[model samples]
Target: MDSSDFTCVDVRRDGFVLHVVLDNPRSDMNAIDRAMHDDLTKLFRMLKQESQARVVLLSGRGRAFSVGGDFEWFRTLRSPHALAELNRDAKQLIWDMLDVEIPIVTAVHGYAMGLGTSIALYSDVIFMAESAKIADPHVKAGIVAGDGGVVAWPMAVGPARAKEFLMTGDALTAAAAERLGLVNHVVPDAELEERALAFARRLAEGAPMAVRFTKMAVNKLVKQALGVAFDASTGYELLTFMSEDHVEAVDAFLEKRQPRFTGR
Candidate 1:
């Protein structure tokens, strides 16, 4: 409830809408690091207890909604203990987001990649900027699209289209994403925040119990999908964390070069 309780994420209240900003100071691009990841998990869990909050408007503070996972943090997952913690946190974050009864409206801009894309996809409504791009580029990092990506993308765009983008780690423009039904709306980059916030405020002003129950009912389908696939996908992703190819991919990403994967 209190913004002071979090370090990486910024939380504030505007009337009945809770404004949650992904503002990781460690990355100008707002990449999800360990701190941000943990903060998000805690934030969503706390949302359930906030009596005054009726809706959540989630966005980013920098040039990006998020550029996916921090490669520096990825390096730390090489250890078994770290990977186990990641697996737990990844699943908990997605589950908590789904469990929260409040409707979440996301305003995505710049780049929303990997976990970032997953977060946006899970929201009840998504508003993407015209110049912004979205992608689940876990494959490019030599990892599985396990953290909500596997569950959300296929549901949004269908399995065939999802597989194409997920496997190739291809980026989709706002228009393309809209065409695929991946996002609810696309606005000019400048108007992204205003439009998304307006919609969130509208949701907030609606009949509270009716809105909350509607969201809860709709999320049953998502929760079913999460139950069916999330654990297995994340488990596979953790296995990939120990792969030689994952090591090369992270190395190349940081070194600014193409990874030479040997399928190890």
Candidate 2:
């Protein structure tokens, strides 16, 4: 397949392993968009065929892991239909990540914010860089973190901490993330990729059927909970986009200043 097929993800074969890198080479911060969401669908569909694909590694080139949704795209979605379509696409993208039978290891470095944090959470194992800053700042953008944040955070950490982080949109250091069980391990930036690959290879060596079944069994409860919450919160998140707070948040981001959000 041509590399150009995916604008947000880089696909490659690495000796029985399929390496998918999130490479927006020109953009230091790769942001999620419609194209990326479509790319994710294609990538996961292809993954189903690669039975030999024992492990999948997700990473990003340049400074950031991801910066979440694209600003231009968000600005374009003003109407109810556009917003609903956007949410539907996004929900499918996240579902693909959650349902991928193969093991995934996200090697995160530098900044991982907004949907970036959701991407990491979807992975079976997330290895973070010592200097990485991870946060779900969707609320800062005036959207409820209805995706993986609401579905996964409380399960990963405690509900109290999840509330604090999701509500405040505060960034967490790698060390703090480790304490909260947000990531599997923290490595020096230089060793982040190496460690993640090593761990993935270890899982790959195990019995595939047993591993897949075990994963599904363990996640049954989580799957049920996510199904209910993701549906309900989808509307809540889209409603926020219609509010003035979302407009102000986007404006502040463009203006390069703090947003003074009023609970309107």
Q: What are the lDDT figures for the candidates, one per model?
A: 0.92, 0.82
User: Candidate 1, residues 18-113: lDDT per residue as tens digits?
Assistant: 999999999979999889888988987887777888999999998999998999989888989988988888788888888888899999999999
Residues forming the 10-long window of minimal summed lDDT in candidate 2? 41-50
- Model 1 spans with C-alpha error above 4 angstroms: none
Which candidate comes out best when scored by lDDT? 1
Report the error of model 2 at residue 192, Å: 0.7
Candidate 2: residue 102 Cα off by (Å): 0.7
lDDT of 2 by residue, 1-264 (tens): 436677768878676456788876446787776677567667766665567677888898888898777776788888899988878877876777667788788999988887778888877889999999899999889989977789778888988999999999999999999999999899999999899988888888899888877776766777787887887777899899898899889888988999998987
In Å, residue 180's CA in model 1 sits off its true spot by 0.6
Model 2, TM vs. native: 0.94
Q: Candidate 1 — which pairs collide?
A: none
Give the Cα error of residue 106 in candidate 2, in Å.
1.0
